[model samples]
Target chain A: MDNHELFIQGSRVPDRGPDGDLMTLNMGPQHPSTHGVLRLELLTDGEEVASIRPHIGYLHRCFEKHCEKLTPPQIVPYTDRMDYLASMNNNLGFAVACERMLGLQVPEKVEYLRVVVAELNRIASHLVAIGTCGLDLGALTPYFFCFRDREMILDFFEEICGARLLYNYIWVGGLSHDFPEGMDDKILRFCDYFEARIDNELNPLLSFNKIFIGRNAGIGVVSAEQAWAFGLSGPSLRGSGVAFDLRRDDPYSIYDRFQWKVCVGEGLVGQLGDSWDRYWVKVLEMKESLSIIRQALAARPKDGDVREAVPGRVKLPVGELYCRTETPRGELGYYIVSGGGNLPERVKVRAPAFSNLCIIDEISRGALISDVVAILGSLDIVLGEIDR
Target chain B: MEFAELLGHIRAALPGAVLEEHPEAFSPWILVARAQLPALALLLRDDPALDFAQLMCLSGTHLPASASESDRLASIFHLFSPRHRHKLGVKVVLDSADPACPSVAGVWPTADWHEREAYDLLGIVYEGHPDLRRILCPDDWEGHPLRKDYVTPATYNGMPLD
Candidate 1:
């Protein structure tokens, strides 16, 4: 069937009984699409969902309490565990928080290198988000194509650092180690190959496909006003036609030097703020991140120091600070209250998943059960970030 | 918004409570009486000029005074304004004798889980939260560990609370 004809069809909602009533169902604390230990109690009137209550905290690791006992430098590694899909971006946030707290200035070369690695990590994260989003929509082939390029990024990560998934590469003052031998070429090659791969395989396989587009085009919709009310950041907010990217609005690093497009939701080409718009926004964002990565690499400085003198252990000032950054999902904010000692007085993480997931109870009020999974997938929630 | 002006706006809305404003950071911190939190939250949310509609985060912390056996706990509310691109922080001090405060779930539904989290971890009860069950920790878990004077327990439900 054509894409438009396919879009005209609705999800498979089971018919009610003689009295004409539906049943409620719990999807997870173990389902795939809720994405890691999330239990969504779905109230359904047949296969059509009446409401959804997301029960999180199955993976609550007490990360905030752990931050209380550790020093500023000690907390950088913990950010990795929150959203493991994009570890470098998490590391950058911790480093920026510590930098702002202590007023530490990194060198120009360090800034350029941080930008390159962070943008690369952004691309890697978007690949996973888009790939899995497509997988949730039943396009299984794109996962292989997306992960194939993602493996190249992981190879570059392993080359520079020792780990694949959780690279604690970005330290408090600067990077853990400078770029290894011929590291720049591998990254450049990955970027050059990424665009053509997305165009040929990933994009057409999902965004342009009839079934894929129909499943997601108008399934789950969130308006710009609702997006702001829910405190969404990153691509989830951008997917709702809001132009509020922290990278551009609140430039923490060398984002000012690079020029890239902020891909906002264009209504899924057929429906605005639908699941398809949310999914396609990330795919387009990956392309934009590649442009940023290219610019950051082109203006690279070779002979500058990547390390600075950060105190091994120091007490923070006796006060509180709330710092936020744009992560792969949305706004990941850290609210730390320091007691002017080795440990934080209290550390609270305003995770993106927690905020983004709040809107689910509103948006999924009348969606189909299958579309609820599609909508949850489109939100791109990580349970670690949600339950932290 | 200027830190003093923001505090002044909040103070004007709720006249009975004392307001504390600090200028060290761009975001100002407001100190309101524990009893006035719900009203203050409503005022902040309903006021058109300072329509801080979004509750970004709600967290509880330990007050660092050396007084033993005293209830020295503090709760902070972080509010965000998307229209103005600004943020304001509201905090209240609760004592051990009666560590209770009003809930903001009535104003913003997003505060429901956050308030329950605070109640679970810090033992600061939100008087008006509908379903105030343990959010992150076990339902039968005892003692708020996030408090400064919390005693470390060896075991809970036959497993180490570690």
Candidate 2:
């Protein structure tokens, strides 16, 4: 089978238009749809993308190198900068790795509260993903609706931990601050409101829009076998009809207690593993995040010291620990090698976006240039994490 | 399969390649011969009983020379099986003089970028990588930045860094 037939069963554009002259097109380092400094060197035969070679590292900060120089606790802020959209998730992954290395168990209240904030951030991150994905397809209305709803999450994050964008609230031993008084009730209200907004306003406005569906459906299809081979996780894996979730499968933190469905894509408006399937998976995941947030809020203990287990000085055991948490995008893992010192011997971040971004060349081989943008938007990569 | 069973299976498959196994650690890790990395990786992916299909993370670290051991560069691959819900770590420690690892990019296509990133930062050469060019760093950049003794370049292209 040719590349076009491999992607879709009855693809109309089977022939590459009689082997047209190949043209090289550079998309982004600044393009809005490429999403944050990611440049794709697209080899195009007329409009169909012959292949895509993505050039990353415009945001490389050497996070692991910096981790070696700093103490374990000091590394939390650096983790925050990675995947800046899901900073709390990054903080939680690193904190879990450090706590595991130190053999530190946090309080019940801390566990409950950590779940709350992490889930909240998940919704916030997904809101940006769905919103920008809409904008990529030229739907102006949902972009505003998403940002307007997302501001509520940003406000809640700011109240909990002073920063709106990059909150390093989840510390290694425990949280940096208490779950703000009455904050739980406010998030509950937002959850109820956002659930309705997704169904009534955003869904009709962007997701089912005919032009948007036409653009995304059957575009840049990635098969399940290819997804596993490419090492995709999070929504990217789930989008391909795989029921692999670290929260469900791996059971990290207090996630096992909460009852939330892992929303694998069901080909709501397109072929299985199409760009539309991937995009819709993120939308369905927001509902699951809401369920998790509500459950975490209800089950959270009335009171306990948030920072009860905070160490004065750090002395970690000499061992390697690989801890992975389910971030909004995918599995955020921290592979830490501690050497019985204040500083870590090696800190390697298994960034979700880094792997998710690598699949472009595979799927974009026979897609239109515009479909490449839609497919990339569906992958939902944050270059901050990719280049870290 | 348990750690011992998997280790036994791997040992049976490639007896010469299996160096050591850490059963008591946080995760089941195996230290493998550097040259046998591709074979080990292929087995880990293809063997139905030990199906570790995903290369979740690939990291490279530089270890300073100690009293007992010489300077070495280590490449660690974290593998996971979605079907089995299990995890295993494979590590290869390269000699300091010529740090080269046979690329597992063929086993896991995702390892292509990971190996390039490792090559970019730590200078552990992935010998069989199709494109082993520096990924995070520019082609003109000198000296691997993640090595223990690496010094920050004061200037690049006549522009002062500090």
Candidate 3:
């Protein structure tokens, strides 16, 4: 062999081997279930798994650095891309972080409006989670059903905000623009239609079906103790018997005025907290979210400023703060550090999918390969959040 | 709990680290010395009175404009205790010279990935992390991009960072 070939071989770089004991498989940089550009290296023992190492950062667009470069208003649009499925929630999160630091109090009307829009975003996000979960488990019918409902919600979002998927509608102090004319009536009608259809059509077809139950129930079992240790939050944690919902337990954005149940599983068809338990938690969460929307709509505020009367230039003080909210996936937290400037010095997002995805290595080790798909599907990971 | 109460609790636990309380906000924050971070975190995790067991979020932030080295490079850990339904925020400062802190992966295995992301993007090395390597950036990528003074290179795979 040539000297160059000898030198390259001397370096212990990993390569595909025909008879290797540990075969490495790339899950996705584009695979459907990854939710985004996440690629996981799965080391398996023929068919059974030995180790699952996540290789992330394919979509790391240096958002935190970019946030430092732009004015606060300019940065609002970028938050849309972070957790794209729940962009409104991401928008609210970034706005609240800045608002809290600045000690700005939003109007009551704005609060109620925020709750309505945020709840709609939450339901829309959960639909994607549930519909996509169904898709991963070899069911195609539910995707169309859930998306059909999702499209209706998106139509409402479009009427209120110009954009549908990545709506940067919620701005600092208040919404980018107040709900357009007749936005309230449209949202109310959508909520009523959603609430009725959930029980009649969506629940029976997706959550209550015998086939879905058999596929998800008793699979990807993560005990309550394990869930807490691994920092599982939102529906995944609630499903594991922890009645902690940030909207209820830790009220933010006028959530204290609303009443809702933190859904936990009694394991109707399985043990304490399996994939089915988590799956059902999302279903119940959507119902609770609809209730929240209804209440917020009823208590609409008459007159107040939606936008805060702050300096035209927005800047955070030279301090650090961590603000979190319950997203459809779990707890979505944003940690921001400012050096008393127009742009934040540092911004770190504690995405729920990252923590939720981490537990896969611990739980999926012993489950069958087919069951791994179910476990991952039930975990409801959005790779955009995971990779970011 | 109130901000003063959280400050008092943290003060009682870690006598070495400096504490700052912001009464304006609903929650209080504590700034611990970089050297005493792991011990302080251990105390918060182990002490029943301040059992901040759930590491809700561990993140890194750059403060390049801050005058003091104590504030320039910071890694914050937000802990939540479901048992008590209380939250605590902890911060540690790292200097630009060597941005390394003890790995909390031992305390929470999930920190394994979070710390790597911090190391990869912010250049804050979490020492003793079992699998400490570039997570979000390619192994050959130069310079941490999250630093305040970072200049985005021309292109990554022909797409400009801008």
lDDT of 2: 0.87
Best model number under TM-score:
2
Q: How many residue pairs clash in each candidate?
A: 6, 0, 0
| DockQ winner between candidates 1 and 3 | 3
DockQ-based class of model 2: medium
lDDT of 3 by residue, A65-137 (tens): 7776787778888888877889888888888878888888877888888888888988999898889888987
Per-residue CA lDDT of model 2 for A1-388, tens digit only, reads 2433444444446345565778899998999998899999999887778899999999998888898899877888899999999899999898888888788898999998888888888888998999899899888778888889889999998998899998889988988889678898899999999999989988888888777787788777888989988978899988989988888888878889988898888777778898888888989989988898888888888878888898887777888878898899898888888778888888888889899889999998888888888999999999999999
- Candidate 1 on B1-162: residue-level lDDT in tens? 666687777777778775566667534677888877778887888888788877878888767566565547778888888777668888898886678878888787778888888888888888888888888876777877677667878898788867
Q: How far does residue A161 in candidate 1 sit from its true spot (Å)?
A: 1.4
Per lDDT, the best of the predicted structures is 2
Given candidate 3, what's the lDDT at residue A220?
78
- Recovered native contacts, candidate 1: 0.42
Clashing pairs in 2: none
Worst 10 residues of 3 chain B by lDDT: B19-28
Task: Give the lowest summed-lDDT range of ten residues in model 2 chain A.
Answer: A1-10
lDDT of 3 at A202: 78
- Candidate DockQ values, in order, are 0.54, 0.79, 0.58
